[model samples]
Target: MRESTTLLRSPSNLASSQRLLFNSKLILPSPVPFKPKHMPCKVFCSQTSESSSTQTLKLISTLRAIPDWADGIKERGMKKKKSLYNHEKWLQHRSSLRHVRHLLSSLSSRVILSLIPPVIFFTSVAAVVAAYNSAISMNWLPEFFPLLRASSLPYQLTAPALALLLVFRTEASFARFEEGRKAWMKVVSGAEEFARQVMANVDGSSNVALKKALLQYIMAFPVALKCHVIYGSDIRNDLKDLLKQDDLSIILSSKHHPRCMIEFISQSIRLLLLEESKRTALESKISCFHEGIGICEQLMGIPIPLSYTRLTSRFLVLWHLTLPIILWDDCNWIVVPATFISAASLFCIEEVGVLIEEPFPMLALDELCNLVHDSIQEAIAMEHLIHDQLLTKRKNHSNEHLTNGRPTS
Candidate 1:
């Protein structure tokens, strides 16, 4: 009876130990320990001890079979998860800007079209009516209607002069628009050329770190210009990919984005001067970048002055007021068309001039920032490609040296 009781107690103890070990296995990071309690046995006291030892050995062997027992799989998984999160953050950062749709929608074409017809119609009617009235008052008509007739020559001359002045003013405004566009193109071209020089011949090496630093200045310039013209302030985190943490922090330190970028470029150029033995080439590149910034600044800072604006506006208003009165007497049916045409011509001229005056502001109808951003991105991508190629070539050369039984320098 005593032996049976002991035997029953022994089996129950082993079962409890095995259950504990199995539960612990779920939380353990590595190889599970082998033990006699995890296995069933029908051996005597001395044999039971041996069987227990054997079961421990078997458990150890099974634990060794489990993959990831020795390797840091959990650490690697955490790292991978972290990398994915960073990638997502980077994508979001790059995509924060407003799109081209806003620019397209804000264009001045509709506004100009709407204002042109009224201007032309009114002006034409005024001219015709003024001529008829002058002819009657001056008695220059045929003798049969001498009482009502007058000289029409003064009216004829006055109408032509006013029409000529309006046309000339319109042409002048358009000329300014054309000039502004040319200047913007100049800025874009200069920026591209400067970036190319920096990437290609500046260091004669594929240094991604240095290239990114330089590209930041190039990328930031236009954005700064746009911000300056539109908001009169340079806000933070405008271009995440181009700007580094340090650059942003420094820029935000001051209130001006354009000036901040200019200072950064200036400092970068100074550093390049110190590092580069060739002084002249660095100076030329720096000069070009400055010139581009200056051109954009010129456009943004000096709009067609308010005085000119006021004069043009006043003249247009005065002309419109007199137009109806002059045309009311003659060509009453045609007055509407004449007034509309004259008004449209004047309004279109003014609207176009205003649109082009500040080219960097990016109106609904103006050039999109995507064009500038894409250009910078392409330059950066090309630089990266070149850097990768250089690295690969270096690796290949090292491998070749090893295969040829030569020491790599």
Candidate 2:
């Protein structure tokens, strides 16, 4: 249900999410500008002969394999809840604590809301213990039960150990978070380089259609990778305008989505007319995409060791459960609120560490993928402009040579 309250519901969220929190909750991103998938096919048809009609027919036959539009809407509704905010927004209020309004909003945040249940359970335990002490002091009962009290010595000795456990737990999770971010950064930059190499090196004049389709494949890699890391992602809608029906179906059915996109890229590269060396150089760029994919898969498949995580959780819960007893001798009835504050603060830190253990959702992957798509599409439009200017200037030079029978200076 939290997915229902995603960024797409509010127009104002568009600016902040464009890059600030490129991390998205929805399987589908907010709408970006795009050309229809069939536009490139139509343009290529005008320039080529009848034999190309065979590829067009194949594309038409695959159209029936696509699911209905209504089915897509229902599937998107099923993705598990994505991380609501990245670490940046988590500490946004630390700088300005002068206003009471900021304090109220902080308390209402999803992070605090999640901690309420555990914090309440600990506080109630403290209240019951305090009541029992009150009854014994009033002589309402005999000294039959031992006092729920602990000395300061054991706590003093274990304090350093508890501090180290929490520090190590948080540090490890943050390292994974940083690694995921860097991995995505590599993927985004790699996609950009591949597109740049393709547009500049490949001569689109002879086979403009293949050139257009290859760029589509390059753009689809990051989107496919985004889906690969984030579970419950269906590429059919995300890639509708970038791939043909047949290619889309192949990727959707494949177990490894990003690998499928790379195969498409490699096949397109082979069909293009280019020097062997240039093709090799472009293939090298495609290889970098696979490296990024491997890093992402490693992060998702292998988490921080389970035993360490379990130890940390068990330690935090036990520490809070016994906290009131240690503080009762010094503060008596004040132990109830002390227990509340301790549980809320310590548990909040550990919860954050746990949330970021898997880094994709905390990273803004959808937004980065969108950036890859826009950059390639913009380059395609610019490439056509440059080609037209070069053609016009060449025609002028030809006319001068024919009229004067001499080369123009």
Candidate 3:
């Protein structure tokens, strides 16, 4: 067997080769094929060099379609191309009345739909009871029925209890939701402040890579924190392009990706800080990240007590079931829509609390992450630009010194 050794030596080889060699596996024994010992002994190629070249070109073109920043991050931001209009912009476009109309038209039907299930359940019970009562009144069923004669005392007593239970449930959940929001706000605020400090205080003129790494880690913190709170570990797709392979691998392997990112950031910051004690202010800001993550973890782990939740649910079901009994006698077949409106309102409140309690996905976390990312990118870019300008100035100064026959530092 004649073994052919060919090295596709280029920066674009990994991407093009992966696409070209995916379906085909060729086995040819080579003692040492590439620099990596793990490299496959078999080399697979597309039919011809021309096909590989064509596929490579196509891949490059496809890659070019993606807008990646110089720091290897793609700005994942609002996809909508339409410009957002504030009240001022709206006034310029149309009259104040029209602007007011547009503002008022922002109601979401999806929110209404979300509250329908519980409303429908309660309404069905009301309808069924109302229908039964009508049948009894019209001689379809005996008026002396045991259930019909059953006292409404129990239902009356428990109604207030159920109301109180739901109120407490909603209030508690909303508190957690509010706390989660505040915690995340700290994360965003800390990330921005930290990025600004690192860019402004840390001298990047001597080492741009260190400054860039610090900013990248700061941006990655919130994203990692989000994934952690949500119990998701698939951060490679989010941070893969933003960081080097080693840093990315460490993040993937760590149990807490956010903490890992923080450690990396702290290490980078420490290296930049000549006197550790002098960086106490920046260190405190970094600590805010840990505090935010801790708060989120508390919210995620410690929910409203399960027994309390179960009791509330049971009370709600029982109360709604008997509500039709009391209302049937008074309303006489006009209870369905009434029950629907009441139940819809109550259930909507409950659902809203539950949805916002975790507050990870609902709080526009992606938008916040993107915002932090953009700010960090801007800060780093500014630092790099300034560093480049300083370098150019120093070079010109050195050249002048040489021309004038003076010793240059």
Candidate 4:
């Protein structure tokens, strides 16, 4: 029976059964490939992390470059702006032919009218000479009368000395003018410095009236000096609002208004500095005030020497008087314009010297005083504004602390 069953199962079936049993004994895997469900998620996470890290590095690099780029742009802009400002300022002082043209263009009708008197005088003198010459040439007047035709040698000899005299005169007057200007500048600087010191050093911000009064005095000092130097009697217009009636009256009634005002200013500063050691600075500034006044008074008292001035005037008169006669022989009608030109030049130079000698009205003291007044007014207003802002900030801070449940000392 066993032989018969073996014959029924072929050789192939026996071999497959043998292989299965062998594989089962060895633990063989399934035919389909093994893959995790989260394999794609892992790949995606790694890729995203790498990309994010690279992007973060790139962002950091860009942020680092940003400030450098901004700084470069700002530097370039500043340089360009500075260069542009310099170029504009350079344009003002350029030495071009326009300067001469400007002078010519500025000649006005008033200038021409002012010169007419000299022109008329020379023209009349020349006309007279021409008429006399014509009479002599036509034999209407006797030639034997010997028309006093003087040589130009005498006039030429006097010219050098006369020129020197005029130059010295003008120089002396210009020196006085320069001194006066410097003195006024000293006054301005001293007053400004004193005000600044008082504003900075003195703890008088609490007393608004006192601070305003000090600033008022600073402003009034220059105005008073201007008034005194220019011989202006009425300062009520300038000081009506700046000062109390009593102070204004004191300044007005005093013979030396500037000195009196300075004394009052000093007294006020002394009172303000009673507890401080900064009064020395005030004294130094007061000394500067005295120096300015002394300089102005010195200029006013000491004038150009009378002898030199008289000599120059005489020389100019004689020169003009003889210039026409000297040129009448050769120039005839032309001498008139020539003499007018010469006389106008000399007289204008002399007049300029005379005008600048005083250095008050001509230098425009009123305008200068107004400028100083405005500056002090503006400075005081600004300081007061700043003080008010500080007080407001302190109050705000204290209120903030109180609101935060803290006590402020």
Query: What TM-scores do the predictions have?
Result: 0.53, 0.73, 0.64, 0.67
- Residue-wise C-alpha lDDT for candidate 1, range 1-409, written one tens digit per residue: 9987787579787799788999999778975677655554434666878989999999987755433232333223222211222577677656745355434654333443344344544566566565665676677786565322234454556667565655655565566656555665666676676677676655635454665687678766766655555543335656565688877787777776666777787667666633454445655655554665566567667766677667667776766656655555564446556666667766666655654454443332113344566786787688779889999999999998888996558
State the displacement of the C-alpha of residue 348, model 2, in Å, after optimal TM-score superposition: 0.7
What is the full ranking by TM-score, best candidate first? 2, 4, 3, 1
Worst 10 residues of 1 by lDDT: 75-84
Cα lDDT of model 3 by residue, 1-409, tens digit: 1222234555477668786676444444446656565433323333466688999999987665432221122112111122334698866778758767655653433344455456666898888878777777778876686444346678777778777877888888888878988998899998999888776666656647887888888888998887676544367887776788999999989887888898998888777744565466667778889899889888888988888888876766776777777776566666687777677766666666565555565566767788889988877677678889999999999998888896558
Q: Encode model 4's per-residue lDDT on 1-409: one tens digit a residue.
A: 8987886487977788888899897897756655766789999999999999999999987765644554454334322211122576577657586688557854432333344555456566766766776677678887795553578888778779878877888898888888887888788878777888778777764555666687788788888887676653367887787788988998888888789988887877777734456777666678888898898888778778878778877777767777767886778768767877787788667756765676655455666677677777777689889989999999999998889986557
Best-matching candidate per lDDT: 2
Name the lDDT of candidate 1.
0.60
lDDT of 2 at 29: 71
Worst 10 residues of 2 by lDDT: 65-74
Q: Which stretches of candidate 1 lie over 4 Å from their true place?
A: 1-109, 112-155, 201-210, 232-234, 272-279, 301-311, 333-337, 361-369, 383-409
Winner on TM-score between 1 and 4 is 4
The lDDT for every candidate, in the order shown, is 0.60, 0.81, 0.72, 0.73
Index of the highest-TM-score prediction: 2
On lDDT, who's better, 1 or 2? 2
